[model samples]
Target: MGDVRVIEVKQSVFAENDRRADALRAELKAHGTFLLNLMSSPGSGKTTTLAATFKALRGRLNMAVMEADIDSDVDARAMDELGVRAIQLHTGGMCHLDADMTAQGLRGLEALATPDAPIDLAILENVGNLVCPAEFDTGASANAMILSVPEGDDKALKYPLMFEVCDVVLINKIDVLPYFDFNLERCRERILMRNPHAKIFPICAKTGEGIEPWADWLVASVRAWQA
Candidate 1:
């Protein structure tokens, strides 16, 4: 055995992360909380859409949010003003927030929930990366990925995994559709090919067009899961 030197590679990059995420899911399930992990490219209006969504769901259901980013808690601060329990997770230098990070974030949010009324909906605004974030589960009951018109419809083909795992595909910034070259038909065709079961919702987060249907679908989805 010439010099017999070997380095033990016992750790998985995502192993610990997945374990923590599974636990988080169990905890939320026990409380009957439905988790929605929102994914999208930076500036795709995911955070803004979340704010609008929370506004629409506030009185109707017990809601909370865990917003994750590489830096700055601005998104969390923005949601807090809307009167729902919300917290921010700074991923430090991590490009994508995994299960462990989300678990801690959810803990902070749990404290924000009312004592008598447990959380019904907990939306995780995943770190704004259209790629790596889609690989991890984050213990979300469903993954909702937003694709804006500015990003173009060809995105579904380029990032099939993201579209494949998504529970819903939201076409944001539709009001500006006329100004851009986004092809709606091509977008839907690609998404359906990746995930036929994924429900599609088109909306302009800035103008609030087609948001009600998305919100309604969300509310109904939560109720269905809870029931």
Candidate 2:
């Protein structure tokens, strides 16, 4: 019988992607741009939260948004209406954006940016799915995810990797906590168990409740990255 060889395709792919992600991070640092990778499940109000964030930091920072989706320019259009340099990235049915795809999106954003006002904060709204996005490094300065109250508190337990990779977790739709069975404290505990260093903010993206802290964190992060 002939000898069989084993190949670790997934491991090799991840290692290569990680190397590219690190290079991308260095490039972004040289350009003085802070990239944030935002993730969430579909219908998690990711866009609405971004709208609130834009409103909070509009004049304070030169910002741009790269909306990644399987297919759709709707989010990009919405962001454009908000007056930011917005670009839609079609992932061609892929559930996530790797470092190379994120770098390509950054180039597109660079073309849209003006000379006088370069992008200080570039946000990549990653494809809406917890599993695939968590497995790929997008070379973002930080990773954030939105977990709405309706999604329940046990999400951290089910999607441990998603919680572990996130630097911040926004508990959105807190206004409806009364109607939902979600426990804010328990959710925080679960998230902390998965990632002890994660900063959590319970917010209502619809009414702009509890957005100040989240926005403040972003402002600090951007400034720290640039400094």
Candidate 3:
């Protein structure tokens, strides 16, 4: 007879992470907080957009931001100065934040939110890296990608999965469109082809151009999600 087989089960690579994400989602729903996972490459205006967006929506929404970076707290500091409850998550050299990291951030924000108003909005500015971050679920109500004109319009074709998974796409740095060869129509066409349900908004974060509509759509979206 063959020797008795022995099998040792091991920890799930995504066990704690998925659990935390589920809990975080439940907590946010209870607090009426809408979470948006903003993802993009470095210099894609993710931070700039958040700074401007939170500033615009503060009076109307109880907003907070969770900034994720590999090392620096600079983005978090900037968002804090804007009067939004902001916190920095250092991934300690990790390329991306899993559900576990976002759960901790949610707890911190929960502590700050008032019980009455609670946190109606939680913007999670994901790590600068695009590919890895896109792979992890951070317990956000929606996934958004900011693609700057400088990054070129062909991005959707190259990183198909990111565009495929995102619910919204922000075409940032549009004010500089005159300099770049980015064709807005082509970008929209390609991205929409990949994600038929995606809502695309073009805006220049520095000049605050086209922000109102974007923020409006965002607010309406969150409200609809609550409903």
Candidate 4:
């Protein structure tokens, strides 16, 4: 029998994406912009959490948001109303944004920036999906994901790669924790098991509770990244 050849298309694609992501990171460093990739499943209050975060860090940082979705401008409109430079990136049925897509979004945001308000922090609100987003490197300085209380505590176990890749995980909707039966401590434990270095924040985005620490961490991270 003749020898069979196998092509590792996925591996090659990931390698190329990783290289492009590294290049994008260097470019962002040169521009002094910190790109944060935020991921979560649908109904995780991702946009609400961003609104709270925007309110918290509004004056401290010149920020912009790129809301990525398969098809929707709602989040982009919501963010723009917050008085920040916000744009929507349509993924065109793609479940995740790759480095190239992220770079395009950044360019759109850069065009929206002004001399007085250059983007120091560019946030990529990735498509609302846990799996594909985690698998793709979107050239972000740091990766963050939100797991709302209603999503349950075992999400870390089910979506281990998502937890493992995230630099931070915001346990949003804490105000409803009482009704959801979600174990915060156990969730933290599971996340730590997946990623010991991840910073966990228990926050109620609706009520603005437990947001300060997360905001402070973000501010520190941006400042450090710029430095």
Error of 4 at 182 (Å): 0.9
lDDT string for model 2 (163-193, tens) is: 9999999999999999988889999999999
* Cα TM-score per model: 0.90, 0.93, 0.89, 0.93
Q: What is the C-alpha lDDT of each candidate?
A: 0.84, 0.91, 0.84, 0.91
Which residue ranges in model 2 land beyond 4 Å of their true spot?
Answer: 1-11, 70-77
Question: lDDT score, residue 208, model 3?
Answer: 88
Q: Tens-digit lDDT track for model 1 on 1-227?
A: 58888999999887877787888888878878999998999888987788778777778888888778745434555676776777778788777778877888888888887778788888888878888998887988889989999999999889989999899999999988899988898889989999999899999887888889999998898888787
Instruction: For residues 1-227, write the lDDT of model 3, one tens digit per residue.
Output: 98999799798867777777777788777767899998999889887788778777767777888878755445655666666888777777788888888888888888877777677788888888768887778888889989999999999998988998899999999988999999999999999999999999999888889888888988897787677
- The candidate, 1 or 2, that scores higher on lDDT is 2
lDDT of 4 by residue, 4-87 (tens): 999766566599999999999999998889999999999898888889999898789888988897455356666776767788
Worst 10 residues of 3 by lDDT: 70-79
lDDT of 3 at 184: 100
In the order shown, what is each candidate's alpha-carbon RMSD?
Answer: 2.5, 2.4, 2.9, 2.8
lDDT of 4: 0.91
- Write down the worst ten-residue block by lDDT for model 2: 70-79
Q: Which stretches in model 4 have alpha-carbon errors above 4 Å?
A: 1-11, 70-78
